[model samples]
Target: MNLTITLVFLVLTSTVRSLNILGIFPYHGTSHFLVFRVYLRELANRGHNVTVISHFPEKNPPANYQDISLAGTIEVLKDDMPVEKSYTSIINTALFLTFTGKENCEVMVKNKQVQDLVHSKAKFDVVVVEQFNSDCAFGIAYKLKAPVVGMMSHILMPWHYQRLGIPYNTAYVPFHFLEGGTKPSLYQRVERVLFDVYFRTLYYFVTQRSDQNTLARYFDEIPPLDQLAGEMKFLLVYHNFILTGSRLFPANVIEVGGYHVSKAKPLNGTLKKFVDEAKHGVIYISFGSVISPSSLSHERVKAILEVVSELPQRFIWKWNNKTLLKAQDKLYTDSWLPQVDILGHPNTLAFFSHAGMGGTTEAIHFGVPIVAMPVLGDQPANGAAIEESGLGVQVQIRDLNKENLLAAFRKVLDVKFRERVKQVSKAWHDRPMPPLDTAIYWTEFAARHTNFTFRTAAADVPLYQHFYLDVICVFSIFVVILVGAIRLSLRVCRSKSPGKASEKKQSKKSKRA
Candidate 1:
């Protein structure tokens, strides 16, 4: 009996051996950090030791998790490039993120604590890096001699899939930032191709070179960024088919869309009272973390407030400013609110959002329809997808007015929209396992299997060959040769006919003579 007990203990211990994981997420954006934090917390809960380097560190972390602060990065961004005025276009956003990402990477790698951890005898089994504007974090993986995994906050971009040798067919998969319905028109498809090419070129020449220089600055011997990217064993993408639509994904790519979403906590006293008193239901309004509603021009803010105040439903707006606008008794404003809990409330009718992926996913999770006011980046695409799903109506910020806002509210509040959202909520929750479990399982699986065999040969193929431009060139040459041969044969036949006619004329002349 003692021998059997000892054997059982041995097996259990082998099954749950703890792993050391290092996560590098140096971006200063709160939403980005939140997404990474979800997975880090999950890993810690599963008995893995997790160390995270992020811009926003947790005040009191769990026992198994450690947080390294990069708060200074935020101050640098605020001083150099103001959030409200910086990201106007796709190009501008890319440039801003690229520069800031590199700067943050340098700051983290050069920190005394981080440098000590790197040079110490401490070892990690795996390194997970956020694949945004920074590729410098890959140096940590190289230093520890550990396999690397990439974490993405939104849908996979062209460069993300291309690194895994996945086909980036722009004809079918629209660019992540483009705003269009499921069925793209001819012009829209052309525009998608152009946008894809433009961004891919920009990343390759500008962002990629910058990443290489940053990596070189830290590590004495490191592989090129492209080669290191291709060597990644797994990618955890924060997207799902419910909103993004179904598409082919490579074996190494895993979708954990709502991993961060959890059961709604009870609202605070003030919020609970306000929500319970709303007999006619509530319309929750928020523009998400980065873009404050108060940052809008006075005219725009006034227009929005006027429209919401006239609605029959009680309004709960997330206004960051201390001053409050005059409104009816039913209208309420707060500096911050528990968004997910409010969305899950039975009294919540519709959500006014910037249509960010995190907010959009939460609204879908709770069966709340949306009034999308997309500002920039992937917000427009998310808004378009929400509208295409028949669960929301999009209102452009520049075109905001009383009539348009009222129409959008009425459209999204219709019973059909509510029913559609419920259907989607059901489908979104029907996965075989919870998203967090799926993420943890894949992350551990990657740690165990350092080498991935599922990568496609397309990664090694030249660009010209991957797109079949060489085949087109060869086909064009063959067609030219065939046409020339046909023309030559026709000329020979005509010459023969003239020679035969002349011979016949000579014979006739001889006969006449």
Candidate 2:
């Protein structure tokens, strides 16, 4: 009996700490870095070792983890991904090619950096990758000898998993089409259609080499590309209860909620001073790190400053560099704002932002209403979430003029706006688990179920599945194509029918001969 108890205790201890993870995030964004911080820290808190590879060195490495800070300096996390090789152009080309499905992720698998990292993996026992970069995940994870887990932040790519025909609870996975405003325009709709076709062909192209390499890495023969879905170990998506209802999910896909988190800290005095004096309450404007204030147009900058200047609410702009010094009179302009801290202040009523995932998550964390003026990509989706959930309002870039800015500010303060945000805030806070703890729990969950496959409808699907389900009208197209081909062939055959015309043609041929 004592032996049995001792054996069970050892198994539990081994299961939890058995994970030796190497996290790969070549992304040069703070938002991506912070979202995973709580979870990794939680894992570190559990006495598990963790490692990070980012654009910058992690100033505070996890407590128990080792950081193989390969990207030069800890500050490189704040730096840009090296794109000087006309890399951006290659990426754009890849994106364009991938829009239809030309996948080059395998090249990443075989890349020098990828190979070096895989070769360097001596003590590491598990691999964790951010799904934000499909290339990085496919490359490194394909080569790693350890169990690999992928973390998907946005609904955009997680749905790609769904598209592959993996069974997943759709209610939980973030859907861009949750609301009408987010629905694609005619051009966007057309682009998406062609993009899928292109991407399918592109995936075949990009992964052709790496897929072979991945197979060889495991000492296995290469299988059909379509079978790639079944091979992945596990996938975790950042989602909460409101986001996920009772939905079917693949054996591998898990919802590890609260990926969006702020490094815990109290507000400093300078940040606090600005927040308290904003009599009309404060409008926190931030665009994260990559969008330098120096890059925007003077006219647009002037308009933004002027409009926020007009607002009765005290404006606290988080600018990388000052565009308009005029706000020095009533507003507080700071080159660096402790964004999460400022959002938590009592005087803050609304956030004027580009709706970055980090900023949005902070807003959600504090339950602050948002005036989301999305710039591009997932920012729009994040902004739409605020509106969709009735937590805040979304303003477009075209409408950032003074009048529109005032209107948006006023709308956020309206009784309805506050009420709605309060409701969402309550919902977010009322969760059975806080995001940090939830993240911690799921981190261990991944450690527990390391053998599951993280597939959604996407990995299990084919072109035929899409046609039968998403494109029901294509059946008519098949009929039309068949009928047209048959009709045209019959017409051609009839044209040379064995009647007088054929006999005349034969006689003419004989005369010529």
Candidate 3:
């Protein structure tokens, strides 16, 4: 009887399955790292052993989580592209990613810890990798023989979707960096097409080759980058149709935009007191983890300060500098604050933001209106989307001045703007489950069912065929043949008509004679 009970216990213990997940995100950007960290934490909380290879690791991670830091990689990347200079332009951003991605990949593959993980007998159920800049991480998936899932912390780019055979029509889905509202003009559409073609060609000829060479250095045999990308079981995009226009995505692609946001934590005593004491409400200002506020030109900073001083509302500015610019009665300056909690506060009136998707989504979640001052990458696009949604006003960085800032504040502070954002927030919260729960379900589903069946044939199809150039060629040939036939028949009729006319004239002459 004791032996039978022991056997039953063993069977029950064996039936409780747990998974091993490996996340590879070697990017030095804090925003990118934070997005991956949220998902990794959730997996750990759900009883999975999660190991992340990243440049920035959490200070105190949960029990089942481990972080393998590639912090040295950031030093090498900083030398290649200085952090002080803003990479605002699309070309500059792309070039920066191209150079830094190659360097980071080399650093990651050669790192002692990562090397051990690769060469050892350790196995992972699923491998999650950042798909934006570096493709070299795919080597880890290949080495571990695990199903791969690519995670994007921003909206899907045209090139990214194309790899999975998803349609990325330039007409509707503008290029990621194009900074304009929805319903683009003809000129904007043309520019979007040209930019898409240029980037795609550049990636195929240059960036993709660099990635392949890097992967080849570590692996004996590997598939082409496109094939490896298409092999991903799922892609978790940090975007939603509410912000990005609704479009059809492959079954493997999942939207987990606000996975990082959660119930507002209690603020520290100092911040809670400051916010609670504000009489006219408070404004929260932040440019995100990257893009230091001190880097702004003196003129721009002065203009912002002037506007803050003039405002009747109290302000909390997240300026990551040792010294404050200027002390004012109404302004509170700090290196960092709980942005989501501040936005969630009833006393908080509006957000002054750089319009990053993370901050934009949080504001939407908390129903806070915004005055967006976009800096780089997708910030401008996010700002435009916010404005189009009637929740914010966008101020061009170059056009920053006291007048512009004040006008933007007034526009966003309107009660109508607040109402609009509240409606959006309600819609966001109306989902069947929380974003984190949905993300976990899809992630585990991918691990259980390594799906390659959902991949579209579009990736394998040639560009010419994919765009139906052959159909256009065939139709052109038919039109040409029809036009030629019509011309020949007209010529034949002309010739016969002249002959008949001459014969009739001769007959008339003979009869008269």
Candidate 4:
């Protein structure tokens, strides 16, 4: 009996070993950070010591969770992001991320709290860093001497393809910022190629170079930023094949797309009564946490308001200034709303969203159809996918008129659209394992197999070698030489032929005469 008890104790202890994990997410975007918070909290819940570095620290803490807050860093993104698609808008966003990313990195490394952690004898078993606009966190993970795991809150960036060996077939895979699904027209394919080249070049020459300069200020021995990125043990991408389309991924690239979405908590207060008692169901309208509704032009706001007034469905608009939209009996406006609970509610009919990845995933999870008005970044592609997948319709912000807005709502509210969305939601939830478990397992997998080789050799190969351009050059030279030799031989044979010789002599004699 004592031996049996001892064996059981051993088994229990072995199954749940506590690990020291560190997560570094320096970007100040709240929506982006929310996607990662779920995994960090779960790590703490699973008896691991998890420390996170970010601006939005938890108000309440669990025993094993801690935060090293970089709360004072300048907010990288604001309401300045344009609400329309244009060449100027694209350039503005690229330049913004490039320069502001450097500023954020500089501020993070210089912080007193961050410096203390860096200088201390901190021993983390594994480090997870957000693989977004900046890669300066990789240097910190190296300083801690821990295996690194990269977590992407949305679709992979343009530059990530070559380094990670993920194929970027421009013919099918639409650029993140463009508005076409997998089956794009010829014009969109051409646009995708140009955008891909532009972003990749900008990231490599400007963004990575700037980040490396910032890293050199603090860590003298850190490798190049791209090299450290290529060294990551695993890449937890917040995308699924159902939405992003089935694409190839390296062994280390794990898709835990919908992990951040949790079971909706019961709504309470005025919000609960508002959603529960809506006679014709509710339309949840939010532009997400980044873009403030106040930044919207008065014309756009008026258009939205006019359309909502016409609809019989009650509106729950997430507006920053509740006074901006005059309160009507049918409309409920708040600065903050329980978005997930509202979407999960049966009374919720359609979602009017900016099509940010987090909100789009939640809408899909709750089987709520979306009326997407994409503004910037990956939203255009995501919005297009929503329309292509039959999950809903997309209304471009450039065309945010009452006519278009109402049409989009009518399309999403159709019975067939809702039923199709339910089917997609069912498929999305039908994963082999829950997304949270998949994330935790891979994160632990990285820690446990620290010595294992997860990066592909393609990461180290030069572009020319990877694509066999040199071999193509050599083959071209051989073909040229072979063609030249055949032409020379034919000329020689014609010169030496009896008929040709007779004809040449006759021509010479006639010229002499």
TM-score of each: 0.88, 0.72, 0.87, 0.91
lDDT of 4 by residue, 384-417 (tens): 7788777788898889999999998998899988
Question: For model 1, what is the error of residue 388's alpha carbon versus the real structure, in angstroms, after optimal superposition?
Answer: 1.6
User: In model 1, what is the error at residue 91, expressed in angstroms?
Assistant: 3.7
Among all windows of ten consecutive residues in candidate 1, which has the lowest summed lDDT? Answer: 78-87
Off by over 4 Å in 2: 1-18, 60-63, 73-125, 136-139, 162-188, 195-230, 241-251, 263-266, 323-327, 450-458, 465-513
| lDDT of predicted model 2 | 0.59
* TM-score, cand. 2 vs. native: 0.72
- The better candidate by TM-score, 1 or 2, is 1
Assess candidate 4 and give its lDDT.
0.85
lDDT of 1 by residue, 36-137 (tens): 787798788768999988777778788998977777655623212222322246667666656776677778877777777777746888889998776778
User: Of 3 and 4, which scores higher on lDDT?
Assistant: 4
TM-score winner between candidates 2 and 3: 3
Residue-level lDDT for 472 in candidate 2: 64
Model 3: lDDT to the true structure: 0.78
Per TM-score, the best of the predicted structures is 4
TM-score of 3: 0.87
In candidate 2, what are the lDDT values of residues 255-280, reduced to their tens digit?
65555555446666756666666666
